[model samples]
Target: MCSRIEDVITEKARTALLQVLGPLPWLEKAQGEVRPTDQIQLIRPYKGGHELALARWGFVSAGMGTAALKKYAMFNARGETLSESRAFGPAFRTQRCVVPLSAFYEWPTVDGKKRKTRMSRPDGLPLLVAGLWNRCEGSEGTVESCTLVTRPPTSDLLSVHDRMPALLLSKDLETWLHGTPEEAQTAALTSWRTGVLQMQAV
Candidate 1:
């Protein structure tokens, strides 16, 4: 499972997202590696187009105490069991989102030790990854959070990791965001092809 991701919401990425999903006038620009519990930008389905919202990287359910967050990890949700998972099933059905990235990092063993690897598209466009979001109301305030969806790794990246983030192509973004439950399930299960990314030791 991936616990870290590289920079997202760059200027280039924002442009790419706007080009495909149409104008998101309120989308803010940001850049940096993201980790669990970090606040990040999420593209959500809204008003027949897309809208930009801010959400913490990890999924937080209603009434889930702070201490519980430390006990469980909800940053990445497995695609295969999404429908069966209490933490992910509801969001998977109605709260699908896109997590855009300039690149993502993975640690793979090289020689005698594990080395950091950066994986990105050859054309330098943003990679739109599938995700599920939720809103939890607590005493402090309302917290919105999200979790990335992952599937079995492609052959090209199997040596790097056993699972990879589920990516959404431009054509399928709508289906993922607003399709019926069944159609959305199909979109979630579709993994991007291999060779679309180039990995480098970093």
Candidate 2:
């Protein structure tokens, strides 16, 4: 299963990203909590290259209660099903965003024993995971939440799990965030094949 990754963004990483993804007032107010309407961050680093872009939080909705507990919390949507799934189709058509992380966590089960692994770039850069967002009205009030998109793992990620977050590159962030339906689909289907990500036992 996928979980929060460790390795803080720190002041340097945050400041660097802000310089690249300018005019992002929302990021100044961002904290670590996964709240509705909170700004999600995105950073894209190329293979053996510098970071491409940094984005502030976007919006998304999480399934509540039974839906959340049982149905994966809408944290990830399959890239292959973006054009088909009812819950994700609309978001795929519009409202796409990027999620930044220095690392992410996944649990591996070997011989009935579970082990946690931390995945991150070998060069210590950020990884950009594709995301979708939507606003929903709840009894409490209006909330915005987001879900990460997933696809078959790249060769580098297969040892950890069958699926990995759909990682986006700098060249495609604009299209993924503001492209037509077909463009979004093409961008989503592209494989994440940059930076050597390391999976260490945590």
| Index of the highest-TM-score prediction | 1
Residue pairs clashing in model 2 are: 39-57, 40-57, 41-100, 42-100, 60-144, 60-145, 60-146, 61-145
- How many pairs of residues collide in each model? 0, 8
What is the TM-score of candidate 1?
Answer: 0.93
> For model 1, what is the C-alpha lDDT against the true structure?
0.84
lDDT of 2 by residue, 7-123 (tens): 246565566556545433334433333432234554332343223333223233444543453454556688888888877888778667667666777787867887877787776
- Computed on alpha carbons, the lDDT of every model, listed in order, comes to 0.84, 0.62
Off by over 4 Å in 2: 25-72, 110-112
The TM-score between candidate 2 and the true structure equals 0.74
TM-score of each: 0.93, 0.74
Candidate 2: what lDDT?
Answer: 0.62
Alpha-carbon runs more than 4 Å astray in model 1: 26-31
Judge candidate 1 at residue 123 and give its lDDT: 84
